[model samples]
Target: MISHHLLLCATPAKALCCPDPAAGQASWDSLKRLVREWGLEDPARPEGIVLRTKADCLRICAEGPVLLIWPEGIVYGGVSAERVERILREHVIGGTPIDAWIVKRLPFRPAAA
Candidate 1:
């Protein structure tokens, strides 16, 4: 069994940039490239350095391009191609979560009468 250290929870919509799979395969391809560039499969590293997951819904649709880092439980949102580099260079490689792009969960506001 491959023990993955990083897990990317990607949805089909993320690939299409749409809510469904009809968005074509471009999104999936982009993500795959990122995985490779991140050196997740390096043999010298831990047994399972990285893994990808196809999530039906992570409940953060508004925040497309979201990825979750396990063990730490840090959820990153609104990720783009440009940001991937920083995420890898700083977060994944540096062992720290990037606070600049982090999606802050604000408290729910009640409707006023």
Candidate 2:
């Protein structure tokens, strides 16, 4: 099972689910780079490795640029490139999420293999 599940909304312009598509794209890009740099993108990566993907919409329209991390279910809003970096360092790798940036937090559940 993956250690972390990252869902980022990279919706098209004018979409209600995301207000700032540019920021989402940046966050997506940052996440990709950070994951690989952290050695979490290997095909044979360990069970507690991160898996990230770009999503069409995350259903949190008001804040735009939404990012969700699971199985902790720490949902963050208004994500940008800068925020992505800290999240990768502090949350994904360090095991402590940035509470201020978090918009929602759901019960933690281990990912099914």
List the candidates' TM-scores in order: 0.61, 0.82
- Compute the lDDT of residue 18 as modeled in candidate 2: 70
Maximum-lDDT candidate: 2
The 0-to-1 C-alpha lDDT of every candidate, in the order given, reads 0.56, 0.80
lDDT digits (tens) for residues 1-113 of candidate 2: 57888998866455775766677778888888889887887667755678898877666665768888887878898888889889988998888999999987777566699
Residue-by-residue lDDT tens digits, candidate 1, 1-113: 34333433345534432343422133344556776876776666664556656555556555556655554556666665566667766776677779977764433355698
